[model samples]
Target: MFTSTTIGDLYQIILTNTLICALEDLTTRLNKYKLTACNSDNVENEFTALLENNIRSSCLPIGVENFDGDLAAFFVIENVEKMILKPWGAKNLSLESISLGQYKNEIAAITIKLEDQRRRLTPKLYY
Candidate 1:
């Protein structure tokens, strides 16, 4: 027997993979930092708190435009499954929420990049 693929399936796979990779990268970077210190509990606490704040502040904002774009792309892929299927109208609220999510991811990536750069610049300290 033969099998077929659907656009929705592909989009879901791509989105899931992207999210997994991002999370893995973030975890690896954090673990590397965590292992670098050889200090007292209090010092570790302080440093960890500071890094947490920096990561939170570096995240991006997801706007409606970003969400709508992603949704539109998704719809396009879905439409490929059946040419006669009409595009679903975009929801402003959903778009906004998705945009915010995208912004957060962007911010996370920035945080990771910053941490990586910092580690590279001070290899003796972090490594």
Candidate 2:
């Protein structure tokens, strides 16, 4: 039987799609702004900055906090997917089993705690 996707999976898909769209849009904007032919470092810097700004503007409305934005921006600048795809050891073991566990608890705890802090820290914005 084809069970429906869980909400978590759905949200992940949404976020991943959003990030992919942002990556594409940023590239287009960079081209328009004449950064397309620039050095790689400059291009990466601009993309990271643009990602940071977009997270502040677009993602804040959708409930993503400044920290999440910063983390996501870092991931984009780091080419996290590419890093993940690269072979890690002699046997070419998959990376997810190692890294996902570290992130799962840490990210969940931080997001939850920081969300509480965020609400308390700036009640006006939240309210």
Candidate 3:
């Protein structure tokens, strides 16, 4: 159902309505990254665009089903980690910026917890 509007696009919209409506503070981040405004002519901010695109692609491959606060934090952590590994100048993308109010270590711990939950085994039943 996903179409290519960018000529070279390869998947469903990287940032969908669910992402925009379901997730909070996304617009704020978009504004912060200056992606809220339409580009002029061929001028585009590839770096900031890639920041959101890559993080979404990396975190949720099939795309978001519904909004989960844990998933939201996970996505934020992924972004923060990306910025830390390959920073974009002196710019910062803090969780506080999105009002998550979690420290870096806390985000890591939450991520670990989420991963553990994903790997957790469910009790089997014979039917």
Per lDDT, the best of the predicted structures is 2
Better of 1 and 3 by TM-score: 1
Q: Candidate 1 on 26-127: residue-level lDDT in tens?
A: 445433332222233233343334434454221111122222222111111111211111112422211111332343355467557755765566637454
True-vs-predicted CA distance for residue 78, candidate 1, Å: 24
| Residue 7 error, candidate 2, Å | 27
My TM-score estimates for the predictions, one after another, are: 0.23, 0.24, 0.22
Candidate 1 achieves a global lDDT of: 0.31
Candidate 2 structure lDDT: 0.31
Error of 3 at 48 (Å): 4.8
Instruction: Show model 1 residue runs off by greater than 4 Å.
Output: 1-98, 123-127
Query: What are the Cα lDDT values of the candidates?
Result: 0.31, 0.31, 0.31
For residues 20-99, what per-residue lDDT tens digits would candidate 2 score against the true structure? 34444433432333112333345445444544455432111133221132222112223331111111122221122223
Off by over 4 Å in 3: 1-44, 48-62, 66-108, 118-121
Clashing pairs in 1: 59-107, 62-99, 62-100
